[model samples]
Target: MDSLRTCVACRRRAARDELLRVVLSGHRLIPDDRAALPGRGAWVHPTPKCLKQAVSRGVFARALRASGRLDAGPLENRLETLMDN
Candidate 1:
């Protein structure tokens, strides 16, 4: 059986490996590459456009279930780095 997870941005179920896992660490968004981050996790496609949509449209916050500030800088950099790999 394949592991399944929901993409917070798209609100659709996808294979675990098919989506990127994002976590909320207090005031920041962290990419849980190993999916081992403890806490609530959000997910989005491994695309820059999706990242932009999730951040600009407040999808991440909604998925994370918290209302606070968010910083996209490091997350964006991390996504770019992952895309390169």
Candidate 2:
């Protein structure tokens, strides 16, 4: 059976493998596609819709305990590339 994780955007529980893992990287949000990055991480679906909602709702910052605005550009680019792959 697959483990479950809650999406910070939609607030829905889903299989861990089905969700993307995001970690804080010096005030920036970095997508951990491999889920191997260290430190606290936040889970979200790998879709721009979810990402936007998460950002608008401040879920990423709250979940990661970020002290400043999170730069999600890199993470978004990574997710786009991952979706293509």
Candidate 3:
């Protein structure tokens, strides 16, 4: 059975595989496509809407137990690439 994870943006729980995992790397958000990155991770639906909510509401930092601002540009670009494929 798939483990459940809560989306930081939607605040909804779903199967872990159904959401994208994001990890912080030196204040920058990085998409963990393989879910193998070290450190804390924040999950979110792989959609622009969810991404927007996560960024706009500053949920990533809170969810990842990080303080200060986080750059989501890398994550955003990764999501765009994934969506394009």
lDDT of each: 0.83, 0.91, 0.94
lDDT of 2 by residue, 21-85 (tens): 99998988999988899999999999888988998888999999887788988888987897798
Model 3, backbone clash pairs (residues 3+ apart or across chains), number: 0
Off by over 4 Å in 1: none
Could you tell me which residue pairs clash in candidate 2?
none
Model 3 lDDT tens row, 1-85: 9999999999999999999999999999999988999988989999999999999999999999999999999999998997899
CA shift at 16, candidate 1, in angstroms?
0.6
Once fitted onto the true fold, the runs of candidate 2 whose alpha carbons sit more than 4 angstroms away are none
How should the candidates be ordered by TM-score, best one leading? 3, 2, 1
Q: All candidates' TM-scores? A: 0.88, 0.92, 0.95
lDDT by residue (1-85, candidate 1, tens digit) is 7788877666778898888888887768888888898998887887887788899898888888978778767788898898899
Which residue pairs come into collision in candidate 1?
A: none
Which 10-residue span in candidate 2 carries the lowest summed lDDT? 74-83
